[model samples]
Target: MNIKKENDKEDNENVEVFDEILDKSFIESYDPSIIVENQVTTETNYGDFQHLGCYIICVLIIYEFLLLLLMGNITFLIFGAAVPNVIGCIGENKNYTFTENGCIKLYEIQKNESCIPIIENQFESIQSEYNLYCKEAENVKQTSAFLQMFAMMIGATFGGQLSDNFGRVKTIKYSLFFIIICCFLSSYATTIEVFNIYRFLGSIFVGTKSSVLHVLLLEYLPKQHRVWVSTIFSFSPNYIIFSFMAYYTKNWRDLMFVISFIGLIGLILINFVKEPVRWLIQKGKLSKARQSMIFIEKWSGKLTDNMEKKIFDYIEEESFKQEESQRRKKSYTFKHLFVTWKLTSYSLFFGYSALVGCFINYALIFNLEKVSGSIFMNTAYLGLIRWFFNISVGILDYYVKWFGRKTCHTLAMVTIILTLSIVLLNIYFPLQQQYIVRFATLFAISMCSQIFIANSVAQTELFPTSIRNIAVSFQAVFARLGSIVAPFLFGFQSYSLTLPYLIMVTMSIVDLTTIWILIPETKGDKLKDHLPNKDEWIFGKKNRELKLLKKVELEKKYGSRCN
Candidate 1:
């Protein structure tokens, strides 16, 4: 009886030892929580590197070659480069001549005599008809601009939602199709009324494309390279394309045709481009995610079992890691975006939009005559300078380690204000010898206002991932609304060109102040680590609950052993 009892005790002790060893191995190999935390940092090798490289090369060749071909066509080139100039010229020239105390003497070919010939009896009637037509055309253009602005906002918002619901690729594909159709329709628009309709439709698709492109680019890159890739990728092509447009086409309709051709190529390219693997994983499409991983492995060499495990574990654990507040049983309607905290962000973002719209549309257009020799030269110089500044910033973004995102944004805002203030001073004081200084300052303002890129990154990071797209789209909508209102604001005879800048500066000051007070610093931190601490005041009672839960879990796992 004693020997039998001793054997049973020994067996029980052996079983406990084996269980501990198994638990340790399990923890080392497959702890989903740890995997989730570290997945962003994990360096995984993808297999079949040579094959993958070839595939990437092929895709790039196809896309780049087609893009170049479309861009190189004379009609495409002319439309892209020339139409914006015409638009800019018309928009600016009209604003300049019609403004309070503008030099309208130059526009007056003959003071009392009409440019068109008519018999004395019909002269007054002919003049009246011409004035009516001009007024009607102006109205059409204004209405078109407003519709385009609104459509862009709505499209961007809708695109973001669609991309979140469908895949990024699908959203982009649909947007491209819309763009293509609208562009073709725009080319055929006979009257200003039809033209405006096509433009509104086109703007809608363009807005969607813009949103999708940003989201797609961010998701396609590795986490560490996301900001750099996004900054460069987003702006460089736009500048190049716009620059080309500014240099070539005279007719707006021709430009529309060029853009449509580009859209067609973009649509074709979409067939070859892979859906973002990160997005695939996020949406719980594991098979597709793994397929993406397999494709990456072909280029990067084979990933280890541990690397594969980490990726899978991170996706699974992300749901649990969602903020407790976000996971609460609250209504999921879009109106939730208007909650106090969100509203604050939205207001600031709206101000940002207003600043952009006012500066780009009204102020810049109004001030162009004071800067450049002619409309064509002005556009060329403006496009070149803008491109140079954006490219310089893109290159600098990768190297600048000291400047925080907020600091850069703040500096840009301050620069804009200072530049505009100088312009305002120039107008009031009439700097006879400082015209060059005024022009240079305006140029700098145009170049530097792009600090919004950094601001956008900061905004995207602040919101949780679930609401990120919607938040961005809503902010864009407000910005578009600001854009729509800007033309009309400056349209008033009472308002000077400087008035819009002054308003922008005031709003910018508010934006800067709010950001300094309310916005948290988000530079150089991994995205996952940047979440607001549950213990912060903003989180309220939820913080304590989360902390308590964590404590309980820690105690259950390690209490007696640590003691």
Candidate 2:
């Protein structure tokens, strides 16, 4: 209807229609077509919600991750806290007294023994407290470590399933609760068996929470924020800080007591949080999903009394995706990951990259001892560089998107391989001591480790929300295997000083090959934008103009005019 008349003298622009559509009375009439038709064009669409609720929830998740990473690192720190306690074991070897039962080793006795001076610091360690030394020392350490790893594997698999089966928000909250309880108990463990048991149980929740953290971050963040958050969350910069504290405090139990309270931060946030809207919808909890959608509107500063109808319209006409009857019914399990081609490839490449990354990193650490400067300062140098890299990655990720993920990772791996080759050369042909500066060579090698942080962002982008945690968790299992193998590579140092370096170069080449072939360029992709053959309308704001335009034509044909 060209209702404008010559006498009316209209401006060609239709300003009145927008004002009328946006008006309170027009909105209250509840004819969905009025908004639906104009929603395609002529402006003043549904409340202009930004869905900022995701960010609000993501902040809490990030805090949770930071605390968990710090605590995980602390587990290693605490284990080594009482190395000085071995002085007693060294001294006890001198006492060779024969008794009827057995040779009783006595403490504080002046047995004629040559010994290195022991530091008199009052560091109370689990080793000192449990007397895990001499005959059983290696057994104690290896057994306790095995228990934790075994439990962690169980926890990782269980946690993935739990997160997928339950919900991200719920799994995080409940898992953290268990962490607090187990951590507190572990701190007070009075015996070796008790301590190992405590550690094993705590690892379950720790491993579970670890798997859930990245999934939660990606699920709640927008595409842009995910890029930044994924980059930031991928590395733990707090290791140095925890190391300093553990060094000065001289008591691990006290440090652990402090870590237990870390989960309290997440506990507070989880109470008022909403699960990811995509997750809710996928699980068919339509009511809760709609509630979360409204929360998103409110959190994004787009509240409207008319939100009820809008949410319903979104669920019925937009967010709700009904699968075809001919399609196979599938459950959310690890098996789906194998069947999905893109997902399978992503998992394989992600696992391989992580494996090689861990392998190269640990191999560097194991063989780093032969470098010139003080080993402590050299290590501190490495850690500080890594910390700086982690912080800078958030900024670096902006540039990474331009090159594409595959290119970025390939370049990084190649660069590190070159760095390794140079370091190996320096090992055989020692750089002149007077000519070399402090930490110069060490700095070159250490800085290349940033590839792990840079690639971590791409790693997160590779998985879908439905099984993201599963993919990441299982991939980490491979990475853990690499870490285990890395220590053994130190034996290469016995064969040749540069043997580990050669092996690391090989691993880097393998990483580059895997990345080049398997990983798709995930640059500028929204989370899970690579899903294969998605025929259903997913809940996102993009493409709404075309969708609304197509629907409005059907409305007009059906004679459902809002006017």
* lDDT tens per residue, model 2, 83-173: 3222332344553332321212323333565443332223455555554443354345445555665566567677777887788878878
Predicted candidate 1 versus true structure: per-residue lDDT over 1-563, tens digit per residue: 99999999976765565456456563343233431222365433221111334444444444443333232221121222111111111232232123222223323533543333111111111112223323343354346556766777778768767776777778878877877887789678666567667767777876676555655554444444545544444433443554456446445555566767777877887888787665564455656766676666555655668757765665445444334334342322344344346545654664464456334433344334335354445545654665565556555655776655667666666766676677667767876777565455546445443555665666555654445556566666666666566545545535575675577667667766766766666665433322233333234444443344444445656787887
The global Cα lDDT (0 to 1) of model 2 is 0.58
Model 1 alpha-carbon drift over 4 Å, by segment: 1-103, 106-111, 116-140, 300-371, 432-438, 441-445, 529-563
lDDT of 1: 0.52
Model 1 CA lDDT for position 337: 47
Give per-model TM-scores.
Answer: 0.69, 0.69
